[model samples]
Target: MNLFTDFESRIKDILETLESVREKRSELDFGRVNVEPPRDPSHGDVATNAAMVLAKPLGMNPRALAELIVEKLKQDPEVTDVSVAGPGFINVRLSVSYWQKLLSGMARAGVDYGRSAVGGGRKVNVEYVSANPTGPMHVGHCRGAVVGDALANLLAFSGYEVTKEYYINDAGSQIDVLARSAFLRYRQALGEEIGEIPPGLYPGDYLVPVGEALADEFGTSLRLMPEDKWMPLVKDRTIDAMMAMIREDLAALNVNHDVFFSERTLHANGAAAIRTAINDLTFKGHVYKGTLPPPKGQLPEDWEDREQTLFRSTEVGDDIDRPLIKSDGSYTYFAADVAYFKDKFDRGFDEMIYVLGADHGGYVKRLEALARAVSGGSSKLTVLLCQLVKLFRDGEPVKMSKRSGDFVTLRDVVDEVGRDPVRFMMIYRKNSEPLDFDFAKVTEQSKDNPVFYVQYAHARCRSVFRQAADAFPDLNLESVDLASAVLGQITDPTELQLVAKLAEYPRVIEAAALAQEPHRIAFYLYDLAAAFHAHWNKGKENPELRFVNDKNRELSTARLGLVHAVASVLKSGLSITGTSAPEEMR
Candidate 1:
């Protein structure tokens, strides 16, 4: 159904035809040939680099090949004009009937028009928002959460078997700190005067509920137990409470994970999986015991050379060998990461995508090295490092949350600006690029706000349907049967331009999904919305361009069909980004 793909296929067929006419050129590879929209819309609707790609291989000059291809392409009934530009790029102008027919096909497809099967149903594991289960999710976790969720949605829409996962950092010392913090709150709950929260403990009042629940559950029983006995129980309870709070916060943002994988599971019960994975690495000669030089930069005063279990990460492209076990005979964080990746590999995931904070940029090489070592060079692991987001109010820096100490909680952002703004703004920029989210701008009703602008376009389309129904009450506008829509009547220049933008949607979805970049969807929707709004504004200058033409029901129905297609594409794109496309805006 994608016209661009259809054109590309046609171009390939022409190339095949040319190759058959000259069997000597059959050895040339057409794999790199590409068909896309020309840079300048004035040039053409669709463009191809078939001649440029085949020139050197066919032992023919680009312009000569392009002329031959253009001659063959002009014969196409759908291609109204064809020309060679620059070196060998072929620019094609399709007829209005072709665009009209494409619109008709789109109207029939409805919201499923842009769905693609490029992924071929391969399993992809997307892990993000793996914030430690020590407290509620904060603003730091917001970008990755939205990005990861949208990516999973996009992948699923593109035919990938996606697993949205959260890795719980519950096996770390942070969990112990959380336990001690909760214990203090529990003592206070029991009427003990626990004054001035300790320096190393979490002082957030969110833990008070966990403390009160613990006090009610065991009362004096836990208080009588030794530190070792009580600490485990306290840690488990605190992690559960914190994870519950995190999940609730995610729900507020309208995000959900298919699986919440625990890092502790790798090392629990005497490190079974960790040992097994390490043994597998050992069998592959990736593990070794080594003593090394001190860190390159300013060495620590207490730095000492010691033997430790190390992975030969450098052999697989890591900057340096990474430690697996520390001097205290405990597994390093990297060891747990390896086990986690191994678990995912065992689960039959063909691709593993980690949406991590930009601060973890240094960790990428080693993680990729681990993936290569663990999967025997078959695992495709991609890490998307999301840069920081700075919140602004009226152009001033927003202050931190007093409730959560130094950082702003994710719920705080969602509560203030609402979910749609939060989700949209999060991915409005590239993951590796920093974003500035302005509350004042996001909340504004004007078209300057992207989410509002896009939603308003959808609302306007719905508004058109309402206007059409009232203008022609007996038209039966609710029917999905757009076959009666006389698309040939949709010949207005501005209207054709809007439809042209709509035609780029499937290409946008396929490209964004293939690149694993969801921000492209956001940008495309903005452009589509802008084009739609421009067309809507055109009607104001000329009343004859109005969507509801009581004097001309044939053209009116055709225009409404176009509006319906726009709305459907908007809703489909919004759904993939986890944002709602409102039919009405209050």
Candidate 2:
């Protein structure tokens, strides 16, 4: 159950009662009301702004309205205390029974306890880690991949029908470069002593296998073919091999996408789809011939003002008109993006989200304009810009890669520190903020490492349950027994504090899902883990507070049930982040 949601409803019920009692006063709308935990826990368990918001409109003094609301709320059986504070805010302390009941409900629901239906099964397409099909994924692509995967998992848990997608950048100048790069390797494979790789071509040895495969398939025949003929063949084979390598890297991090949409497909079979998308925009009067201003900053010496087929992106929300077709009559990258957006809309996705790097910040407005223009405002597109991740080892910056030569590959980090640490650390901060991932800190088995701390809390919860089973051999201690625990025995304040934190899990899931932020879950888990760990330490000082009580089996069962709830939530949260919740810390 969402405890805050329930309390909000109760508060609204009290307001409605007030409206009926004071008919002479103006009717006040409660739609904008809010119920959240107080900034100061000592003030109350939950705080509501209903009285403050409704007071002026209802022609009553704010304090007077708060008093009236408090009077009505005090009658609620679950509301043990109610007071008006700080001008008009209503502070409410729910009965201990309220939290106890929530704990029992959590045990009963287990990992499914925090699942919500706020999304209403809407179809959402989340595209991320759409790295070019030219080489292996680098560390730059790591954070976005984890963020998108975890956000997708979060949306699904919140009842959205989600499709994880990657837009394969296979139809760009970069692929031509990849083809030429592989061709050099292919020539070397066929006993030709190819000298130093050209400056623009990829020089990574990872493409050696692709070159070897091409040689095995076509022998020296490809060498004799014209550049146009062999380029296509080599590009296709090289792209496929590179995508395979990229998939392996993603798999190593436990990140996978449901759709790998190819940019080539947008212009496949004679560019029909690209033409169709541009025509649709033209018909809507959003396409026309125009010349863009020489780009800001460095004006190209060869820059010339000439007419080109342009999308009037400014008609929607873009800062300026965008080019759709180049002077050579080839569709531009933006044109292909328009077609990609159209394809996603036609696929029935009500919402489309692009997870991009911080460098793509300027692309957000144009993409948003395209979505609004293509869907005619029916579908929404949102872009999340994930900032860079700085790698560290023993407080020193870590850089360089064996795969790409210039930077670290995602596989390198995963291979060094296990997948769980990589996944958790990637999302331990907000996407827009830069993150520092330290090898030493993440691997440490201490509270300083959030990944280990949260996992340790889960492991500790399971450990206590095992201890309980051994201490009280007669107790069932099964799923049935735990759910049916006598929670009334949980009277300790520290024990209740942990229960209070658990009660907030449902609200946290709902809010995080609504905001499309997975980092919130990571932070919430760390806080919850800290609370559990603090309570556990308290037991070391007070023997009676220890969860496993040999003589007091009833209290032990209640404590075991609380521990079960904590473990269940930790597992659920970790699963969303694509991390594991170990049964044992070691």
Total clashing pairs in model 1:
0
- TM-score per candidate, in order? 0.97, 0.97
Q: Which residue ranges in model 2 land beyond 4 Å of their true spot?
A: 20-27, 299-304
What's the TM for model 1?
A: 0.97
State the lDDT of candidate 1 residue by residue for 1-586, as single tens digits. 8988899899888877785336755577666888899999999999999889888867789999999889999899989999999988899998989888999988888899989999999999999999998887888799999999999999999999999999999887788899999999999898899999989999888888998999999997888899999999998888899999999999999899999998878878899999898888999999999876787898533233788888999999998888887766777778888899999999999999999999998789999999999999887999999999998999999998877877889999999999999998888998989999999999999878999999999999999999988888898876645644846787887888888899999999999999999999999999999999988888998999999888998889998889989999999999988999998998
Cα lDDT of all candidates, in order? 0.90, 0.90
Q: What lDDT, from 0 to 1, does candidate 1 have? A: 0.90
In model 1, the runs with Cα more than 4 Å from the true position are 19-22, 298-304, 483-486
User: Which 10-residue window in model 1 sums to the lowest lDDT?
Assistant: 299-308
Could you give candidate 2's per-residue lDDT for residues 1-586 as a string of tens digits? Answer: 8888888898777776775435743455667789999999999899999878887777778899899888888888988899999889989998888888888899899999999999999999999999998888888799999999999999999999999999999997899999999999999999988888879989888988999999999999999999999999999899999999999999999998999998988878898899999999999889988788988898633334788898999989999888888766877888899988999999999999999999999899999999999999999999999999999999999968867867888998999999999999999999999999899999999889999999999999999978987897776765446766746777788888898898888899999999999999999999999999999999999999999889887888888889999999999999999999999967
